[model samples]
Target: MLGRKLNDRYEIQALVGEGATAAVYRGLDLRLQRTVGIKLLLPYVDSTTRQRFQREAFSAAQLNHPNIMGIYDVGEEKDQNFLIVEYVEGEPLYSFIPSPPQVVAEYGRQICLALDYAHQKNVIHRDIKPANIHITPSGQVKIMDFGLAITPDSKRLTAMGRIIGTPAYLSPEQAQGLKLDYRTDLYSLGIVLYELATGVLPFDADDIGVLLLQQVKKTPKPPSELAPEIPPALEAVILKALEKEPQNRFTTAGEMAAALQIVLDGGADTRTTIQPAAAEPESAPLSAPAEAPHTGPIRVVLADDHRILRTSLAMFLDVNDDINVVGEADNGDQALEVVRDQQPDVLLLDLNMPGLGGLDILPQLRSNWPDVKVLVLTGRDEDVYIMRALRAGAHGYVLKTIGEDALVQAVRDVAQGNLVLGHGVAERVVQGFVGRAEVTSNVLTTLEHAILTGIAAGQTNDEIAQRLKLDPQIVGEELIELLDRMGTASRTEAALIALRRGWVALEDLHNIS
Candidate 1:
């Protein structure tokens, strides 16, 4: 369609891009003499497809935010329908990723504001990945492709089992085919920000099934491990938005924007690690750094292969006066050695160590150092691993994606002989025991998925009650019954089981708080 005139106004110059449903072109507004992007619904689509195509124009037209791509006109000529939008002069946001995290944060805040405006107008951008966002030369963010947008009042066009967004950036709810809202967009944007800071998507793999499952159950490593300079406050905001459950995420794009502003304003308290204890006057070497004093605080050890991760966690943990990181080891052999030497009260262990894997060493540790409460803290959140860890005598299992506060609590809880399960880990264990067919059958019921999702998110009966507009007492009793039926010991385990069976999704596990 190059050089072709449309509606006697837009003169197509060159093809910009082509997707499964439409093609974009650089065009000139004949009357106004300005550049524009003309997105045309490709020929051969049925009437329903054409209607959906026109819906994009209608959806974008209602949104008049600066960061949103502007829709100038929706027209048809010679049976070809098209949308005329403002031409952005730069590449997609993905091209500029691995950028300075602060820059990404600034851009993220703008994207949030734009989303807030659209969401308030009742528009949900079902597709909100990096490719759908454009970054102009002036560094302005322009959200594009409202093609997949669905208004709250609009009829549903997609089939029940069909997923409509990119898998890597998909929220757990989206992957699970649950109803969605503005938080879905925020979760995707969180992925974009994570990639920007860490130079990789949080959940990625060659297989779509693997990617989707990972999004539903697995948690990514902390960004600081990839980019050591990244501030904890910034990582916290990004991780919070990425929560599997929508309620666990920032309530609104505006709230997310404000949170980013705080990070930018240098409000994240990240002081980790205490000065080593002062040496005795006779034992002073005068050349070495001071060591942390052994003052009867909860003695702890960190075991992970990543140096930056160890340092970051140690620093974060050291900030608590009651917790002291007595030793750190990168591999399982080193971990065993350190644990044997220090005899720390608690051990934070990773599964995929080089010399000896966490699984390989767990039985040995249980047999030998039975007194030390081992808490599995790793990026792996699979049911098999979680169950294995528990069976091997681990006191707790926590994912790397867990919040700092949760990490602290897990250590203390496990040290006191209380079993602690990370946000997604418990749900997976629950699913394994319940079996898949039963879980799927339950999710097929209306709003049953919502209840299950609430559980997976670790919500209390009253919280789920308020969210679904049901009676708190009834919700509580029903959950108790579910536990009995599922043969789980507690609500948390039931939720985790539902998660493992894929009846409950990680996105629903809003463990951010």
Candidate 2:
């Protein structure tokens, strides 16, 4: 299903993950020309389950807080139900456990703001554990997975007497299977804060039965007792939220967020703005840097999963007097931040980076920074992939095997608004131009024509060179130059022009007489 198009608008690119309820995909919205996350509910789910899923999705769609994952659309097509959501490029909060008090407060404040907004709308995120929260590289907290969210008017969708929510973060009322309200979320937030500051859950037991009992009956140690670095006022907020009675907890998420804000501001109400989670300059605010002033060099950002490749490329490009390597990234999300912040003249992107792939970010690059040319530097050789990148606004497609000279020239060409393609990629592009009836004559010189015929005949440059009694390097250089003269982007496109004009055919490749 990697290449399947759903509902004829959302094109599925790759499966991001799968769960018991649904399979999530990284997809493209053809109508909007944007990347989105598509969650496809399992077809076998009962009607009640589907209704509940829709209810939760539709309910969450109303929320517009920065910390909440935005829902875009939901629909069913030919028996397949799906929800299109904002594709957040981040890691689950659980991945960042054992965080420092300041960092916890920074993230916790965002979560509280989200909860405040959600609860004000009469929505209670029943599952408020670490796994339900995502932390962006920019340090923003986005709450996700509202599948079990309960509204004030929600009807029971579970078996009677059975509890829902993770036992580790469950409020005492939730553990008792009693009625729930907004205060229950604050209790869970306290558990999350406790875990964040102390690196351990407030109550822990291996047995589910024991865990639930502990959540209901046990008193938790103060967070300061374990972490010692936690300030007294912040610890008081945690203790208040951990109270067994709902009335004893903070009345609203806003109050709790205010308390954390005070701790972050050194016990003052300065309300110092929190910086985004992305790596920052030493002793500088994240927003302090505007676009780096152009200093007479073509700036470039490298986005690839391979560190060795990025380092080698950076080293090679650094020597070029005309080019400067401004930033490097290992994932698509980081790539976006780097490119946005640096505003480089060229973005050397790979196709399959983590979070967001090369293709997924092309539309964004086109929309947000159209002046910054995108040159896909990837190992993908398929014509389909190349066409997709080019159509999605990539200015160039170069393979990893590209020589330093060609790559450097491609960067310079793309920065000047010219399309560039490596030799092998050029051939694929030509092949894709097959079956067109319109013909142009004399696009190739006599020697270049012979070389194209030999290439169609499955002859390598060396083989063709020996047959033509010419130097292989000369043959290769002529082929590359011929592609430029013919105004074709790739070798395949050049080859297809020959094929479409009846200059070559599949039978010619092996028709030795």
Candidate 3:
């Protein structure tokens, strides 16, 4: 479509991406002499799809913030609806992971600011993922794609049968077909942050069903367990955001942003070395400066199950002037040993390590050495994992996918007692709690209750339907109807409420055939 002018103004340059509902194009606005992104709905989309598209455009148009991509116009030409948005020139935030602690903190701060602004406008970005977050050359972060966004007052366009956003980043309430609010977006953002910091998803399975089950039932491993160098304060912030119950998460995006800023301002009061009392000694004579001394190098330790990763990290740190790799370990147990012996300024840990898993060691490390900072460097970026890491006392979280510079910077910032988090983690932690609250109190249905019982008994929907001799679609529809009646936005929330009310049992549901 490049060079093709639409509506006598926009000159299509290239295809940026495509989805089931619409196609996004890179285009030049001849009138404004600036590049813009155009999202055009597929010409043949049904009325429902059209309505959703229009809603997305309208929701985005209501938001005006530096961290959010601006909507210039929404229009239709030749029966195709399209929206023009500010073109971000840089790469996605996902591409810049494992950034230095400072960079991670900065990115997180910006994302929180955007979220706060959007939430204040009563818009919830249901799709909060790396693909939707753009980072400009100047390091400014912009959130895009309100295509799956939902407003409190907005009408539900899709039928109960359809799932709205990506499953991997979905909140428990969303997965369960419950009503949503700003917290839903926060939960998704938490997953993004986890992924950005650790390069891994918190929950992984061979299939989507299993993944969703884990999302609703299992708890995440702490970030500190994965990366020992992360600070406890930072980890606390992440855990708070990832709380399975919305009431446990930050109440607003602004609150989350404020927490991140506090971390960045060195307000993280994490425990450091335990000092023992000693007798005062006579003061030594002062000496002149050998030369104007430079700041001390940022100390770090590398911990992973792979030997090659440790070696590579060590080699990489050797070349950086401000960073120094002081130790290496092959697993969580080994990491603990190294921490005890070397007490490095930062620890880069892996989540799925042998012997003691990263999550298993987080509490131990935090309890034993509160002063040492941890930076989780892993492959998982799920809300569960992000929450677990935060709970375990990680100070910073960066994914393996991050570049060398960002990783180096993250280490430095965490070592300096700053709470640095990758792009999506902070938002997720805050949203997790709020969304949970909304889903639990607002939505519930009879079919959902039946499914919850089946889930509690470890039964899949198919099995539940089979036991009742009902069609899977019927069961799904009934569940959706129940959720709607309960006023919850997502299925995950409905299940959680059911579980809490003893309407379902986790063991039963987990063991369902």
Report the C-alpha lDDT of model 3 over 1-513, residue by residue, as the tens digit.
678788989988887655434667888899989978888776644566677788878888899888888888988888888888887766666555554444555567788889888888888888787767766656677788776777877766543233456667778777666778788777777776665656666776533444555666668788777766656766666667777777778898888878777777874322222111222221111111112112366667888988987798889877876668888888888899999998877888887787777877888988998877878888776555665676578776667777665566566556655455665554454444334333545343344456777755656678888976555655665566456755786667767777777666666555554
Deviation (Å) of 219 in candidate 3: 1.7
Error of 1 at 142 (Å): 0.5
Please provide, for model 2 over 54-105, each residue's C-alpha lDDT reduced to its tens digit, 9 standing for 90 to 100: 8768778879888898888898887988988888876667666777677788
Off by over 4 Å in 3: 267-513
Whole-model lDDT, candidate 2?
0.75
Ranking of candidates on TM-score, top first: 1, 3, 2
Residue 65's lDDT in candidate 2: 88
User: Would you list the C-alpha lDDT of every candidate in the order shown?
Assistant: 0.73, 0.75, 0.68
Q: What is the lDDT of residue 82 in candidate 3?
A: 84
Q: Give stretches of model 2 more than 4 Å off.
A: 267-513
What is the Å distance of residue 74 in model 1 from its true position?
A: 0.6
Strongest candidate by lDDT: 2
Q: What's the TM-score of every candidate structure?
A: 0.53, 0.52, 0.53
